[model samples]
Target chain A: MYSKEHKDYLKKIKLHNLLVKISQIFILVFFLVIWQFLASTERINTFIFSSPFKVFETIISLYQNDDLIHHIWVTVYETLVGFGLGCLIGITIASILWANKFLFKVFDPYLTILNSLPKVALGPIIIIWGGANATSIIIMALLISVIITIISVHQGFTNTDENKIRLMKSLGANKWQIFSKLVFPSNIGTIMSAVKVNISMSLIGVIMGEFLTSKAGIGHLIMYGSQVFNLNLIITGVFILCIVASIMYYGVVLLEKKINSKWD
Target chain B: MSVLKIKDLRKTYHTKKDEILAVDNFSFELNEGEFVAIVGPSGCGKSTILQMICGLDKKSSGEIEVPLNIKIGFMPQGDSLFEWRNVLKNCLLGLELTNNVTKENKEYVLNLLKTYGLKDFIHAHPNNLSGGMRQRVSLIRTLATKPDILLLDEPFSALDYQSRLAVSDDVYKIIKKEKKSAIMVTHDISEAISMANKVIVLSNRPCTIKNIYNIELENKSTPINNRKDKKFAYYYDLIWKDIDYHV
Candidate 1:
């Protein structure tokens, strides 16, 4: 049923995509082999660099001790909580700002200042106020993510097509009706993008909070390992963190795709 | 009977640096089932008059006398159909906004889609529609509200040359068939001559009515066919010369 030229073009595209995938895996494997080879040959210090095999061994030992799952769970839980609260508060505040132009104008400079200031620098103060607990860690994430969400989502709300707004007003729609029917629904993609950025920001804030005053978590594990000079534990913690971050980011991406498709 | 009348309508826009008078002493009237096209130079406040009529923009000073029973429907420049909504939902937007979506209203909107040859694409999104089809859908959306007077603000300007002609023909037929009075704002003089019963010309910035021409065509059926009328070029030249075009 297919034409020959079209079939050939499709095959060429598939081959190119397969090559890219293979190259990605090859690079990872090459890096692992070179690092392992150098450490074994004593060209690099294995104790400091912590080769992949040693990191894997450390993970398995930690798993046997039942500490691995608990630490991972702690960090994941904090990140999830922080992310959820940040999105809710941010969107609520954005809606409020969109509703009242005066409030938006008054808060404009304050929002900019809060957004640009380093949220990590507030970790010590957050610990002092909320104490060394999970709540403080969630608050830290909320602080980091909420301001950005408000700024981006409000921008989206205000950037709705002027003609659409005029159409709505021409239809005799009230302010609340316009916001619900036109502004909010049209900005779904914008809100989803803000959610994506917010998820990563929450994770960063959670890790920083963990570093300041956490008793358990991947951040604490890495901090404790560094203090004890256990490079293997530190490397293992970093590896687990990378995996967790990737999973969360991709989860958001999948959700964004689902929502965009529904809208389309 | 006159359905709507505006007397000495005025609009002034204020910015930080200066105040600009957009419309000055603009007065017109719409008889029942009449099509009036307002044509002027670019930025000559043609659209501001339509906006004030629809109450989208507040008039600085004027008397707009519309019978309390008459509803106003407005079609903006582009289709402005919501991407998330299908053709059916987009058409129902006006009724939905007015909280008048009764079963009869839904049936009325559905019938309009079917009558206008949009039955096959009722469930299709706006992005999938052709430019001409989108404009037709936009007109159907405006007609769905059953307004007595329609305000069209450069409705065909967004389409390409070919589709703009086709869509204008489509829109003219729809308005005439529905027996609704309309005030359409356009920069295209040929479009004004062909589609409207009367063409109103205005002067540049702080615009006022320059001249009004009652277009006399030998045989005027649709916008496309009317373009071939012998007198079409005569009216076009008159309106073209009426607008003050300068650098």
Candidate 2:
């Protein structure tokens, strides 16, 4: 009887999976169809609000001109650099803070105030310190991502199971041993979630920096297109940004799966 | 030789409001290879005694003496297994902490994991295991430290009734096999009688030792088996009344 019920439950899950995939595709096609129809019929001005077809044509033209890869590479490189540096510096500082209670308390109020401050307001200052090159873009992204990482990963490190720490002490584990064995491993979930949030936060910073200064990248393309009244280019840049962001987010998910499989 | 001794042990918690006495003038001596169970009314600071004994918490006054270089392993109320680690790695935590992760210690832990029913679950995460299995993994982790004495604080109470019985028996067998002195605190009267060689009963808050019983079972068997020795129920009632039960 249990086996039969289990079989029926598995069949229900398979059906649910098939229906979900079908609905996803159906929604995308339905949206594109309505968008293309409205633009082609001139119900919406194709000049200001470009159609899906024009956006696709714009992307293909950019590809033919070979600027598409360059623009994408520029943004991807900036985001990757900023992400790596932000996470590294954030975690190191957090570890140092965790190792010293006095240092953490001294910095606690300042960190809270800085985290609440709008980082975009510091974009002009970043240009002054780092210049209008890739360095400044990376700095802007770091400003966006690092504070969140510090707050989150530090929270994870401090919020480990106290009982387990006590157990370690009973077994004669010292401070460093307790931190590495108990504090670090127990916060794996928190760190992964922080990684997921950091990716998007860094992406936003890069795009905002590109808007402020860059002559290339998807963000620059959209800004330039708006100035030149090129609606197709603006729409196309936005489309590529969405796709790129999705891919990067999925990459973090895949990394999460790999790490989970390795550790857990 | 006595592995552990506590004389006039007292623990006072000083909060922002005022100081509260948790455990007051409690004392006991544990011989090598002895199994002692501490039973008291709920919220009577029984676990406080184990914490003081294991040096996890500070005592207000009195002495908790142990032989120098002697290790103490403590299993807390919850399973307290490291959730990120699989059973094997979790079992190795104590050894890893002390830099005692030698080949011999690893082999001993592996043997313990296999000898118990956790052979198939050696690769499984603690979240994936049943409560009984998690507690067994926890016990193995403690035993891996090769502590001269073990302090268990309500270790099996988190489990359901059936798993609690099975786990208590499993734990009893493992403690016996390891030949380590054990001091366990549990609220269950029958559990105290079934597993412990001696039982220590405690009064309500400002806890102090009220009475100690020398448990005797004729068959000398597992915890489940000892329950059938007819002396179990008699000792159970005696300790139950010893506790400050208001109802």
Candidate 3:
């Protein structure tokens, strides 16, 4: 009797999961059909908002033209460099602040002000200061990503188990040992979550930088396409950007899973 | 020579609002290879005494003298095992951190793991293990450091009754085999009676030792086996009475 009930329970769970998956697929199809019908009917001007088919055609053409790879490489390089720089700087600052409570208190007001301001608004100044090169884009991306890393890492350091810290100290573990073994390992989950958030922010910073001032990159392609009223190019660029960001987010998620599995 | 000597130890927490004395003029001595258990009420600052001995917390005023060359191992109330490291890695963590994981030390730790019935689960994560297994792992982690003195702060309090008994027995055997002196803190009178050679009973807040009982039994036995000894009930009653006076 128990076995039958357990089997029925499992069957119900499977059926419910299947229903959710089907509904998700149905929603996606519904949106796509509506979009296709509206574009074909000219309800929205094709020049202003290209059909998915036209965008796909543009993507193929760009790929075939060989310029797409160069643009993609440039964007990828900027995002990676900016992300690395942001993580390094943010983690360093957080460590220093964690070690020195007085320093954290001193810098608290400045961090608040910096985080509150919209970093995109500084695009013109950043370009002027960094000569509209990769430096400007990197600076923008760093601005977008660094605050998150600092806050998350600082919180991770602060939230380390007090008893564990005490235990380490009692076992003759020095300050550095405690930080490396206890503080850092315990905060891996928080740091990974912060990295996931930073991926999209990094992309946004790069695009914003390019949109304001760049001769190349997907951001430049979108800007140029918009100026020329080539909505297909713009849509294609947007789609590629989304895909890249998703891949980066999922890559970090995979890494987090791999690291967590060892312990969990 | 006494392995550890505490003289007129006093600890006070000075906050903005007030100064609160936690441990007041407490003193004790433990000879080499002695297993001491400190039992007290919840807020009696027994932990403060252990913290001072381990040098985790500074005593406001007191003197703690231990042999200069002797090392100390501390097992806190919580498991304190790194959740990211498997049992083997966690066991070797101290030696790894200290850059002292020599081949011989690794062998010693591995042997302990195997002998303690953790051989099959060496690669298991702390979260995946049972509470008793995790506590055993924590003990092994501390023992792996090869300290001369072990300070256990309610190490078995987190375990269920059955697991606690089994773990207490396991820990007792390991400590005896290792021949290491240990000081444990607990609120359980029966536990103190069953496992300790000497039990230190403490008073309420601003805690001080109320009484010290030297446990005498007919034969050597594990903690569980000792619990069945005829004198076990008498010792339990006596210690319970001492604790009750303070509470």
Candidate 4:
């Protein structure tokens, strides 16, 4: 028997959810309208600020010229390759650290230092080591993402409940069994969190790498646009980067939701 | 025939601050299918005894004799159900760990879940289940290994009063119906007296067996029946007094 209050409560929840969705879209559009208005009114110099219309037209031109897809693809490919490798290497290293407490202890301080150190500062060194190519860009992204992934994922593996591990051990489960069965499954949320941060870190590294050397990609477009004072192209590049980042972040969110629904 | 035997078992923790002895010169025998409840004060190292029996903890000095190396299943406090695993998968954990997750074993576990009133919740995750149901799943996971003995550590403490009584009955019935020997460590005296065929009372820190009571009540089928058997209160009081709650 669903009472009136119960029915009302469920309806209220549905309404609240709808309201949240509408408000989120409203905020984005509101910001865009304000920006366009400011540029049109000349309150902000359209020459430098670049009106939304100019940005849109710039995007259309880039699309028509076929450079837009190429640039986006380049950045996306580099980021994806770097992100995948970084996560794989990072998780593998984290597993090694988790398996050997002594090694972890030896590397703990170094890991901490690496995690805190500004990775972009090593750009020149990386360029020297890997050469001024996609190699350096991918390495830069890996450096930015991998150390943080190691630290975060290792923390997750190590922070797995001691009680659960004991329970597994008491069952005569071996070290690998404990890792596969208990530690990894229990830390899915933590690992997903690391992945989210790792994505952003990798993006930052990719953009930074492109800023220094890349002849293609959204980052290069932004840099080149600024050199020639084509503010429209710069703003358009910024918009594209924002859209790409949002898609990737939302993709991770979708993955998290799928995993949680299936497993959690 | 006894499935487990422990004599002169001792465990001491040597730390920087001091040497702390947990279980001290403990000895016990668990015959096949004999339900033993180890009741003691909180922090009396009752769980330590179970851990030592399970070989998860090292003993300083002891003699442990198990004929043919009997399998032992340990269910720790807090359901400890993997939140990520659904009820059926959680139940299958032990079998999966032991590499015994065959078709027959899967069916057997699924049947066990069905018989234990978890038929409807097979696909539900641990978080979706009530405390009692999760505890039941934990117990089922332990039992799936087909161990000669079960070691449970205050599994029902997480449930409310009503659910605790109901689940204790359910667990007791399953244990008896399956002819399983169980050594459950709990601070609840009445729980020990009601569910156990024999109760071992342990003393405070540097814990050792203070007294052992062979519970006898005619027609005592389940823990719920044990409560109605008139002698429940007497055993509860006796063991309550035996536990040394002192510094």
Local distance difference test values of all predictions, in order: 0.93, 0.89, 0.87, 0.89
Candidate 3 on A27-100: residue-level lDDT in tens?
A: 98898788878999999888787887887789889999848988988888888888888888988899888888
Most TM-score-accurate candidate: 1
TM-score of each: 0.99, 0.92, 0.89, 0.91
lDDT of 2 by residue, B12-91 (tens): 88899999999988888999999999999999899888887877888889998999977888998789888778899989
- lDDT score, residue A77, model 4? 88
Stretches of candidate 4 exceeding 4 Å from the true structure: A1-22, B120-128, B217-221
lDDT by residue (tens digit), candidate 3, B1-247:
5789989999999999999989987889988889999998897898888998988888899899998888889999868888888899999988887788999999999999999889999888887888878888999999998888999999987788998898899898889989999999998888888899999998888888889999997774889988999899988888787775532
Query: How many clashes in candidate 3?
Result: 0
Q: TM-score of the A chain in candidate 4?
A: 0.94
Compose the digit string of candidate 1's lDDT tens values, residues A89-206.
9999999999999999999999999999999989899999999999999999999999999999999999999999999888888999989999999999899999999989999999
Task: Tell me the tens digit of each residue's lDDT in model 1 across B1-247.
Answer: 8999999999999999999999998888899989999999999889889888888889999899999899889999988999999999999898898788999999998898888888999999999999988998999889888999999999988888998998898888888889899999999998999899999999999899999999889997799999999999999999989999996
Native interface contacts kept by each candidate, as a fraction: 0.89, 0.84, 0.81, 0.65
TM-score values for chain B across all models: 0.98, 0.96, 0.95, 0.95
Proportion of true inter-chain contacts also present in candidate 3:
0.81
Maximum-DockQ candidate: 1
Estimate, for each residue in A85-119, the C-alpha lDDT of model 2 and write its tens digit: 88889888888898898999999999998899999
Report the Cα lDDT for residue A229, model 4.
Answer: 96
Candidates, DockQ: 0.87, 0.70, 0.61, 0.63
Interface root-mean-square deviation, each candidate: 0.9, 1.3, 1.4, 1.3
